[model samples]
Target: MTDTLERPVDAEPGRMNTRPAWLALFGAIAAFASAALIWICRAGDPSVHYVSQLGATGMPTAPLFNLALLLLAVAAVLVDRATIARGAGYVVGWPVATTLLVCGLCFGVASVITCSPGCPVPFTPGSLVQDFVHISFAVLGFVLAIVAMGQVAALRRRPWMRAASIITLVAVGATSLTGAMIALFKGDTVLGGNLEFTAATLAIAWFGVFGLQVFADHRTARRRAARSHE
Candidate 1:
């Protein structure tokens, strides 16, 4: 118990290792996949309305996928804890490292919502706003992920991370532009489609990478802490 509290102080101040990062990353990938699948399952029509009803009582395979999402969230939490252990700045008003932790809850809740035996009844076209809300949370979380990554990248001075940061910054720019383009060209389905796709994908993938990094780093920090205490 004593060891658990102090373990974070033992890591390379703000550095996280690589092994566990992939684990959480795979989990993050699963999270996006599950969210997409669940959305498709509920989608009465991708264009206008998304039906909440899953058609059948329950999908047998869904259980496994939902579990996968849950696992990814746990992995994310572990990583977030590690960032905190390393004294990684939260950035802005909130702690950036903790965003990954919050995303775990978001993904878990989304999974549970998907797991319900029946989809939401009387699906309204207006529910598109709900979808937007989900996207907003994801975006907010991803922004924080970048903050954490920046800290890690700064501490390590890794070239790959530098490249990743540059790409991510561009993604952030393009994502916002795409989202606006989607709203602007509501009539022109072609451009809107491309914009939405680009923005949403970048947002999901960014969060996904951050989630994995947090999981790997935090777990390693814990191990190092225990060793130091011994």
Candidate 2:
């Protein structure tokens, strides 16, 4: 009798687990697609030091690229929430959630706050506060992205997730270092931009893959549960 009562309850999680994954997956696709469009639109612009620079005033692709960042931010938050819902909550879940939240909010704010034309050049003598704020948010968002990746790598039980997390960590680390170098030297803008683009791509890819995996895992679990019940 107890087994009969508990079986349905036990099956509930499996049945419901895929919902968050779907949300995350949608967010990932939106982020990546928008970012790609921005890059394509802004290609060959020498003045842009990083992807975020594309969203600065006077840039041709400013509005579109900024919109992309907003989409990516939303997607990141969804992915992080999904992680928490999956029962990895005790592990890296909370850390991932917090970092992604930071990433999302920073990105969203930075999108609205346009940088000066010559951003990453130490701000002009009388730059607007928005310029500095944009830089701060971008830097913090990237850093949190790296932290989230590391935590996910350390705590995820799935082999594929660990592998993806490790790869993302490497990509994000290289990108962050390259960005820092650009900031210090104010040189190699192209290289810095490329690295930033790559890092963003890897981040969205990881989120998409992770969400798909979670969704697939839950679907399998549900199927198995249904069979067992039969």
Candidate 3:
């Protein structure tokens, strides 16, 4: 009886597990650690120099920063795969998976094609084509994260997740918008840099939290299934 009851939860192939959650957490920690190392290695005013500048070509921190992005990309990809394994019951499933895939791609592209020194805005004076590409993809990645958050917010079955996603969507959207406006209008000032970093940190942390939620939801579903069988 116990075996029969537990079969649905334990025997299912490709069920969302703890690995992806741990990967997400590790990725977030690595990104923050790399950023801290970059700051320590290169003394620059965070307000004036954007985060991308730390990872720009020729900077001492470039390798570490780029590696961090790659880790993040991997984490996103793994999370997307786990989400897909949840099957059709997941609300906005395809959209969330697609957005995560695109976000991962963007992060990978940005890691490989780092910007020039100063990380100038796209199409501005002294900005290289690669700079334009890097910035565009990075911005798109964050925007897509916001999209995914909105989609997750629609998960009515998961009230905690819905509420958390809504809050994150608002906070990340506000910070990203403010930073983007400052970058576009006034160039990279201290305020813009701070806001940009804030948005990124929030987004990355949310991703980690998202992984935890996925794990919790899966466990809860399994337990409920077992109880129903009993």
Candidate 4:
């Protein structure tokens, strides 16, 4: 028999779920974490051509991403323990550390192989090849963004939340495709190189936001859980 006693109190008309509200909050955390990862990677060296700047800028990138990835990995699994995504989320958690290590190695190698001593010249086939290699890491970032945004959309409360999640997902996919194109057309030409890099940076920032949204979603979810309990 259905237990009326177990039912939560009368529904509040426009109130959002504590869980969902908490979920929305996770998005912000994830975004900041991603930015942190970028800084970690870039912190190494500034004078040399690195991830975005010159030094170890890419250093923070990996660590920050791992932080957000871990957070999303943890909460996503909890919220959908019965869903197929639960299995996927668990898989995501284990890879967080590996991703940082692998991305670091790939980017570092690419950096060295691409440019001669620093990364001043730019063109060299070596650099192109390196860019190609690093593309895979970028692809992973894109994939994770897709899943994170979709998950949020599925759990969102406000109409705008769903809209934002979907828009971000679409942007991630489009940016990835464009990034691939940019990777293919590398050179010293100001038009090609700068444009591609600008696009890539924008895409990365977008992915950062995707992580933020994921954190926000988690916060919203926790809130809902608390509300229900009350």
**Candidate 1 weakest ten by summed lDDT:** 48-57
Residues 8-97, candidate 4: write the lDDT tens digits.
222254343344333434433443454455445445433223243232124434344334334333333322321221123312334332
TM-score of predicted model 2?
Answer: 0.81
Best by TM-score: 2
**Model 2 C-alpha lDDT versus the unseen true structure:** 0.67
List model 1 lDDT by residue over 184-227, tens digit each.
55555546544545544454555566555555555665566556
Write down the RMSD of all candidates, one decimal each.
7.9, 4.6, 4.9, 9.4
Off by over 4 Å in 1: 1-78, 85-95, 106-139, 142-156, 185-187, 208-230
Candidate 3's residue-wise lDDT over 1-230, tens digit each? 22321233333343424453344445445444544554553454343357788788887778877876776677567667656545554447464767888998998898899999888877879999999899888888878888888888886766787898999899988987898899779876788877877777777766766766655555665656656656
Query: In lDDT terms, which candidate is top?
Result: 3
**TM-scores for the candidates:** 0.50, 0.81, 0.80, 0.41
lDDT of 1: 0.49
Model 2 bad stretches (over 4 Å): 1-18, 44-47, 93-95, 120-124
Candidate 3 lDDT: 0.70
- Candidate lDDT scores, in order, read 0.49, 0.67, 0.70, 0.40
Residue 6 miss distance in model 1 (angstroms): 16
lDDT of 1 at 10: 40
- lDDT over C-alpha atoms for residue 177 of model 4: 55
